[model samples]
Target: MISKTTIDRVFETARLEEVIGDFVQLKKSGANFKGLSPFTDERTPSFMVSPVKQIWKDFSSGKGGNVVAFLMEHEHFTYPEAIKYLAKKYNIEVEETERTDEQKQEADERESMYLVSEFAQRHFADMLWNSELGKAIGLTYFKERGFTPETIKKFGLGYCLDQWDGFTNAALDKGYRLSYLEKTGLTIVKPDPNNPNGTRKFDRFKGRVMFPIHSMSGRVLGFGGRILTNDKKAAKYLNSPESDIYHKSKVLYGIFYAKKAIAKEDNCFLVEGYTDVIQLHQRGLENVVSSSGTALTPEQIRLINRLTKNITVLFDGDAAGLRASLRGIDLILEQGMNVKVCTFPEGEDPDSFAKNNELEDIVGYLEGNAKDFIQFKANLLAKEAANDPIKRAETVRDIVNSIAKIPDGIKQEIYIQECAGIMNVSESVLFSTLAQIGKKESTEASKKQRQEQKAFDVVKNDATVEKVDVQYELERKIIEILLLYGNNTEKFEDLVLKESETGELVLEPESVEAKVYEKIYLDLQEDEIELANERFRTIYYKLIEALNQSENFSLSTFLGSLDQEMVSEVSSIMMEEEKYTLHNWERKDIYPKDKKIGVAQLTSETILTLRCFLIKKRMSALQGETREGTQDNRETLEEIMNYIQLNKLLNQKLNRVLS
Candidate 1:
């Protein structure tokens, strides 16, 4: 267990905005930063980070919390992992209690596999730098591709020996379990009963150059190996098989190292080969990664979305290959991501082209040559359709389909006009074609959505229904009032209420708002039923617990413990009531400022709001009618009037106190 002191230090030192800003492209929105939702596919910004509050919220997905919570959600890290991540980020040393041998032995198979994979990554990395064979084989290959020693080390590139059991023997001698080795596909194990100890073993990447694939959090998942020999029987490139922890479709190469640069540049260079990524980063273009030569996938695009939205794909100038690679552009557009394309000079790929040019020249070339997806498509297709009406019409539909993948309606309209001008077709005809494509897409999308919704409804329908209570609206209002105004004690009726004991009346102190909330909470506690809305229920329980624990309750501390949805809901109410305030209460220079409203008045006013709201709700639920425009025959009106009068007094007391 990590010491509580270290955990607290991690939280205090890790700024919410700074940590999240590394992955999310945040823009100023009033008092907070807003960006496209990282957890969902959306064009508008619904993800918000409040620096003043030291928290973040994703309105689209209803996920919100402090810095620790963001890492936990975004990286799929456990609570302890999140704290350790923070400690690493802020340079705080973690203090963990020593575990016993028996406790260590209790590690599950998956965790053990993770440990083995991690150790293998370190071992390979070590060999790359310190071993003679590794330097000659691995470092030589990386340097041949123009990677600096620092760059090679940063990417964890390495090479395993031609000797059959070198890595396997070292791992076993270090006490790593053989079972985990086989499970991770790092060691090839075969059955053998001949020697009684008898399973033959060899390293999976024997005599091959290694490229470490990493998760977003920088943990090594698996390896991609390249062969040095031109053996016809063996494949040129091989990747680790899917295992307990590694999923190829979901992992993007160099994301762990390139995330910060990607966010800083607000663009990612997508290439095909591992060497291409290394060479580009070596040339000082740090914000680049590869698909490991796999075709683009939605999962891969989502990984990029976690850091950026703009992608520039680099392709070789070979026309046939470039045309085949052009299929990925549609996938990028489908995810609502911005895309640009740049093809290198003939006979050169990213690796060779980057090596032959200086950083400034390469950057300038990219800037001048890069074209938007629409223009690139038009240039490629226009030449093929010269004076051929049938091919030209098909080409127009192809472009229109690509345009329809965009999520923003306004952007679609703008692109449509541009495409019309370029194609020399009328805007109306292009718009009509776009509309037809859009209709087809909408129909297909709706069908898929309905299927998903049906599955969700089936599971949801199993639970019993609870209708919203009309009285609860009034209760909610009262709670909001108490939260905002409960601190001002002077606004309440300070007159002591007397109670008769047998024959005489006795005086006692009173707090109207606290008393009201207490009565409501106690009444509900007796029924043992929670509120229907999750946020409201959680807030109610927390307030009740706080009230029960101490004589003084701090609302800010209570609000801090809530999740993002509750905070937004509560903040919306609190802010609506508390936005305007008089400055320098002591210098207001109004008489009787000495008699400032205390906690009682604010609490009472808030409670009064709740009571009135609840009363009105109850009346509505009972289908009761009000005597409109008349003060007589109006018991319900009388209750509402009392609430209004109390609220007016509360505001007056607040102003007077501040003055």
Candidate 2:
């Protein structure tokens, strides 16, 4: 467990915007930061971070909380892991109580795999720098590739010794479990046929140089290792097998190092391998990542989609394997992102190309040579289809199909026109082909939907309608009001029933000045109203106590005291109205009512509405009792009448007509 003192210092030092900005591209909105939702595939900015409140909200996914919550959600970190990440990021010394043997044994399985992978990375890097054989074999190979000492260290380059059990023995000696070692694919184990109960083990990447693959948050998920010698029996490059923490299709090499730069430049350079990423970064080009030669996946594309909508895929000069990568562009288009292609000179790949040129030459070449996906695909296919009618027709269909993958209608129409011009076909012909492709796609999608529906035996409904939960909304509003204005003293004009000089009961405005929390608590207490929602009721008491005890209640401090569930509740409530402030509502001459202008009125009305709702609920219960019960009919009738009168008075004070 992390010490309270250390967690507090981490919370104080680590800024929410700064930590989230590492993975997201945040642009400044008025008083807040807005970005594309990392939790959803979105084109518009729906993720909002309020530095003032020290919380973030994803309007698209409805996930909201403080900085720690963001890490827990985005990075999939356990609570302790998140705190430790913050401590590391902000340079705070972690003070954790020593774990007992039982506690150590109870650590999470996925986390155990992660720890093994990280330790392997360290062990390999240490061997590369310290061990004699590692220096002679692995270090020499990286130097021959023109990587600098600094570049090598920056990427955590390492070497596994050639001995079969070198890494396995080191990890075991350090008390790392063999199960995790095998699970992360660092140590491969096999049954020893000679002895029934014994097993044989070997380092998976023995005699190879290691490149650590990290997640966006910089935790080593796995490694990609390159062999130094040309052993025909063994593969040239070896990657960690898919485990709990590392999925090859989902992990982008160099994403941890390149995420900030990718967002800053609003573009990404997609490459084919590990060194391609390192070479570019070493040449001062930082917004670059690779699929590690794996075929592109939607999950990987969505990872980049969270940062920017623009991608410029970098290809080597070799025509082989070029068409395979071209298909990945259509996947990008499906996600509503822009795609461009840049190829190096003949006989040069990104690694060699960047290794030879200065940064200026590289930038100029990429800028001057980058082709839009449409032109690039057309030009490449036209050469192969030269004068062959069948191939030419097929190429045109392929291009049109790629265009059809675009989600935007306007872009589709514009690209169809552009493709017509490029292929020397009429626009109408291309449009017809695009239409056919879209129709086929829609039909297939509907077929799949029907199949899924049949499998689940779900009933078809005309619409998915949701009725309003009035009590739930009222309880939420009460919490929102208390959170936003609990510390502020406001003048309130509440309607009080009084006897006038004419001896008739009439509602009169009774003015009073008190803190917002004071008014809310007193009103609820007076009515003996308990929140119907259990979660809201729990938060209600906590908020009231915190507000009453502190002269200055800090929202950040208050948030730190609650569990994640309540923290999410408070953040959503406080930030719900702030979403209207995004996209600059006033500049379009459509101004929303400023919430600060009438906080007092809002608070009074909310309390009045809750009282009305509860009273109506009580009257409904009494009516039900009158129907179901045989005794006490007169007293129950009088109780219903009393509740009805109270409900009417609350509705009147709220300026609502009772229907």
lDDT of each: 0.74, 0.90
Candidates' TM-scores? 0.75, 0.93
What is the per-residue lDDT of model 1 for residues 1-659, given as tens digits with 9 covering 90 to 100?
77877776776677778888876788766566777677887766777776765667776786766676787677666566778888898899999998789978876666677789889888888887789988888778877777888888888888877778899999999999888888888999987768776789989888888898988778788899888878888888888889977888878888887889998888999988888888888889989988997888888887787678899998887645666677789889888889999989888888898899999999999999999999898778888899999999988888888888888788788888888988889989989988888788789999999999999999898978888665566456545644544333232443243556774333344544334356455435653545656667777777667666755655535554565456656655543321111122335664332112444444444444444445445555433446343445456666656544444444443343212
Pairs that collide, model 2:
none
Tens digits of per-residue lDDT, candidate 2, 1-659, equal 78988887887788999999998888899889999899887777899999998999999999999988999999889889999999999899999999899988888998888888889989999999999998988889889888999999999999999889989999999999999999999999999999999999999999889999999999999989888787999999999999889999998999999998998899999999999999999999999999997899998998998788899999989848788888899999999999999999999999999999999999999999999999999999999999999999999999999999898999999899889999999999999998888889899999999899986665545446689999999999989888878889999997788887997556788899999999999989988888989999999999999999998787777787789999998889988987887767779999777777998999998888777777787888889999999886999998887677767777777778988
Give the poorly placed runs of model 2, Cα more than 4 Å off: 446-467, 501-504, 578-589, 624-637
Candidate 1 deviant stretches above 4 angstroms: 105-111, 193-198, 386-389, 421-424, 445-465, 469-496, 499-602, 605-659
| Top candidate by TM-score | 2
